[model samples]
Target: MRTAEQVTFGGSGLNRAAQIRGDAAALAQAMADPAARCLPMWRGKPLLRGDGLDALGLIPMDHPVLAAGLGKAIRAPVFLGLEEDGAPRFAHDLSRWEPEELDYGALGSFVDRSEQRHPDLPEDMAFAELRRVMTALSPRDAELAATAKAIIGWHATHRFCARCGVETVIGHAGWQRDCPDCGGHHFPRTDPVVIMLITHGDAVLMGRSPGWPEGMYSLLAGFVEPGETLEAAVRREVMEEAGVPVGAVSYLASQPWPFPASLMFGCAGEALAREITIDPVEIEDAIWVSRADMMTAFAGEHPTIKPARRGAIAHFLLQNWLADTLN
Candidate 1:
């Protein structure tokens, strides 16, 4: 897994500045400083700039959109970290704003291509879905966008303490939630998932969910259950979905998939047999695709199969496998 960190959203080595998260005095000074910048997120979409929407639209603390309260702030801005020049970065949740003629249908779909614009913001800046533009963004911007989306999503869903069901308040510079009633502490969640590259000789196992677009296939994957190891999860998931026994599972790479907060563990496994007895309830289809057919699919020349989405870890693994670089 030499190219593990090269995966999209793998990491950008951003200075997290964790030492000052609990320092009230320092946090206040940083918030008020002119060097402070914020990336406004609307409904899980990050504000992006540039003609190709490749850069984060970070607004200054005193920007009119933020100062004039154009879009309501759902919560206090979360401190992201420090930039290369030691400037503080923050994420603001502005999901309350309702844009004109917003396509409600596309807001939260399998692939949300809808973009929203705030009237006061510059024309080049708009809230765009991260999945659509993740590869176009710089590694630093991609990491920041994923971090912002995951943290804000956690806050949105986990507003109450699990211990007492009492409302919690943001603390630790947006990295934690504090419960006033029971003194309970809660942190952001990142679910562990295993995406396997199961193969038998020159063929790789692929499956498609029930509602996926026609011909779309990807490696078998499932969430890691409690008390289950990564290797065990890979074996169990493939067996459950495709009825294929897997052996010799090994770690390949990882990606911070912030589609509502998930960490994808890419693992390689050797399939025990080629026979695929798909469980209809778990997967709609399962098949062993040969290396030659996989290359044709990746090239968009196969009529019956479409490759996995480009930015996903599945595609990354498949690309490396085809290039013989999955070591």
Candidate 2:
């Protein structure tokens, strides 16, 4: 897709300086430097400030919870030193504060006071407010949100040792966790999901999951199983859901959908058979819509079907495909 990276959370080329993950002194300096700033994550959502949504808010290392986590006795919390416009940026989770806004749906309701571990408090932040503020931010702010969400989510979940059932310690600048008892090293987990656009000539296939809103139809997607190739996964998923035989699958674009950490691999697949055979177990219904119909759907003119999500890769790919720019 020509404008794939133009999608929200697609690509902004932030320098994820992984090389400095092991440099304790350097990481400390970066965290403490006045120029150093950390993007705060409430639950899995990133904080956004300013109009254009272009202003990225950076939480300082001295914030109460973060200070505790990175104390000398407590070992420095894993932090990523990212670079934007030749300047350094940081990411951290304020899962320690109770966010004031709660109506932003699943992304905004992250208050977990039971953890008492101040780092687990949901910050007084709201996802919808952030979105509103970010609507006018510079491109860098949007990109910074993407990076912060991904890293903070990683920190929130990988707090235990997978091998010994013991509490693990953060290490390697927040990229790794070590279990002292088992000498085990753990890293963030990212699951691979295939979100494909299956097409037969001018029409494309789309469906809605059982739990989705009334008319919300998105490209069929499924997790890529162990040992399965992206091409094979596309074929299998399409066949299982719509009973369509797909051939000549190709990569389109990708997005980091960090609801809990997932890499959405957007793809395009050619349909070899068009006979409609909906798998009641996999999808509520399957439909083939012509280019014109899709354009209507995108424009909110279609009465029965809503458009694919705006910020998602599916919407991005479909828009480009309609414009004949999927090259």
Best lDDT among the predictions, by candidate number? 1
CA lDDT for candidate 1: 0.90
Segments in model 2 whose C-alpha atoms lie over 4 Å from true places: 51-54, 63-78, 84-86, 99-139
Q: In model 1, what is the error at residue 35, expressed in angstroms?
A: 2.1
lDDT of 1 by residue, 1-327 (tens): 889888998769889999878999999988998999999988899999978889999999877676543223235788999989989999888877778889988986778888888899999999999999999988899999999999888888888999999988889889999999999999999999999999999999999998788899999999999999999999999999999999899999999999899999999999998888999999999988999999999999999999898889999999999999999
Q: Put down candidate 2 lDDT per residue, 1-327, tens digits, no spaces.
A: 566677666566777788778887877777777777766555545554433234555656676655533322124444555665435676665554553444435543322212111323244432333333333545566666755666556656667776778888877777787898999998778899999889998999998878676788889999999999999999999999889999999998888776567889999999998897989988999899899999999999999888876666788888888898999
| Highest-TM-score candidate | 1
Q: Estimate each model's TM-score.
A: 0.97, 0.84
Q: Relative to the unseen true structure, what is the Cα RMSD of model 2?
A: 4.8
TM-score of 2: 0.84
Which stretches in model 1 have alpha-carbon errors above 4 Å?
67-74
